[model samples]
Target: MKAEKNAVLTGAHFIDGDHAACEGAIAAGCKFVAGYPITPSTEVIERIALRFPLVGGVFIQMEDEIASSIAIQGAVWAGKKAMTVTSGPGFSLMMEHIGYAAITETPCVFINVQRSGPSTGLPTLPAQADMMQARWGSHGDYEVIAIVPNSPQECFDLTIRAFNLAEEYRVPVLVMMDECVGHMTEKVVIPEADQIDIVERKFTKKPPGEYKMFETNESMVPEMIKVGDGYRMHLTGLTHDERGYPAMSPKVQQKMLRRLVDKILLNEEKIRHIEEDEVEGADIVVISYGITSRVVLPAIKKAREDGLKVGHIRLLTVWPFPEAYIRDLAKRVSAFVVPELNLGQIVHEVERCAAGHAVTRLVPHAGGAVHEPVDIYDAIKGVLEHA
Candidate 1:
């Protein structure tokens, strides 16, 4: 659906990443948000609690993150564009619901402003440790979209992109923000309502008695029908048929889970987004995402100045994890230096995709703060010295 004109904040404003994400949701036509306030991410729903009402939207502070996560899915089925906000601990609490959304194919968004954590480890600090958890937190086999934003502007832009993808794929999309990006303030330029591209829910064209809730076309994305629209639907976490009925057979299980994943795997080319630079003759490429992407740029430049040809790939979409791209690039590069806020989350993915073609180096940090670019530069230098 096109964004409501009144909800569009079409101008420049200096705001924190969390607040900008709130406005981004508004511009993307989100009418309902349910969140339980948590450190470093509270400002997102705090802004929503105030601003949502002004734009004919609603924000509910649920009893806890579990309630907050599931509440948004209920809103989605009621034909509202809905989302929930949280941090690391809350993200852990919401894993079950993320699975619910995935199995039910509910169109909703989860904004996790990540903090250092095994369990409330550092509530006010930033961490990218949840990258693997975001990909595989929920139980069962399922694929979900996760987007990473490095700057405040990207926090705004990518949040809208998160919603559009959730709508387009009929799956929960994760806005994986860390504490640094969420709390950092910057100038965010929001465009006019008309200029924004929105992907509305693909509602079923069938009449009341003709629709099958889980039936999908070639896209593997089924058309949705809101509750109270005179269409009967059965939804469960169990393996079900296209009509949404439970079938306990192994074959039914295979079919349901396959589509749950294939819808994303088949469209990897469209969903994957990566930014690359200076790779034609580079000996090593540095891969990073979210806030770490910005932190690594100076190191890349420094290495280049020292006559080390280092390329960069700032991952925009982290989940359908740019496998083919990395595999192809590994054929040319001698090694990959991965520096992230975590010890070594995504570096493993790069290693796996490199397929023994290139050396993979991990420059790890144990959260709370960003990486020093010199550390990254040293890693690049060491890799080249060995090569």
Candidate 2:
């Protein structure tokens, strides 16, 4: 579908990642934003507050992050694409609502401009530490699609994709941004409206009496029905049946829970994304994402120059784990080097997929900043030497 004309900012502009993301949201037809501005992420809503109204959108800065988190769901149920922006401290506050969105199948987006620390470590610094939290921050068995952008251009491009995926799967999608990417300025070219492809919510064609809210077809994503559309609906966080009513039997729990996960895993082919280079015969494959991917580029070039056959896999979508690709690649590579802003989050995932078939080494950091190219270079060098 083409973008809504009023919402499309079809032009080139030099801007920061936060502002680029805001424009992407506008272009993707996201008309409502509810957020409590935190450092690094405040600029996203700052731009939205100014642009949303012009595009017939709504911008609400709620009293706190919890209010901001749940507010977007309300807008989504009312037939609007909605989102909330936040940082570490605020993201923790929003966990309960994230779970609520999952069980109730609310299609919404959340932008997390990650900062460093367990509790307010560095408001102005950068870190990719929230990766694990983004995957498992909410308690329960569910899946989320997360994408990381290394530049302002992708920041603009992928924010639109995030909303599309949310609507496609009826789950909360996360734009896992870092403070560096959020603040870094670069040229972002947004294309004309006709060039943009969008996926709108699939509203049910069934009449009021026939529309069962949680019923699904082949895609496992149930067609949604608006609350005031004269449809009889009941949505709950507890185990629910096809009619959306509370059902507590073990059989009901297994059916509902499995569908929630299987929808993503079984359909993983549609969602698998990774930028791989020279992995055909390379011994060491470096896996990284977000700001860390950017930093690792220089090191990759250096490795190539030294005649070390090093390949690169840059993760665009971090969730659902990209299990198939990693599992296959692990068999051929001598070792997999995993690095991130956290001490060791995604590395465990790499190890799990590799499953003792190959060596998986970690390059750890405690956040507040990114790694130096040399630090990553040395890690890659050591692994290849042992190989």
Q: Per model, state how many residue pairs clash.
A: 0, 0
Tens-digit per-residue lDDT, 1-387, candidate 1:
566788889899999999999999988989999999899899999999999778989899999999999999999999999999999989999999999999999999999998998898999999999999999999989999999998889988999999999999999999999999999999999988888888999998899778888988898999999988888777888888988998999999999999999999888889998888887788899999999999999999998898888999999999988889899999998999999988899999999999999999999999999999999999999986675
| Model 2 pairs whose backbones collide | none
Q: How would you encode candidate 2's per-residue C-alpha lDDT over 264-347 as one tens digit per residue?
A: 788777887788888789888999999899899899899889989999999999987899889998999889988899999999
TM-score per candidate, chains pooled: 0.99, 0.98
- Candidate number achieving the greatest lDDT relative to the actual structure: 1
What is the clash tally of candidate 2?
0
Off by over 4 Å in 1: none
Point out the worst 10-residue segment of candidate 2 by lDDT: 264-273
Q: Whole-model Cα lDDT per candidate?
A: 0.92, 0.90
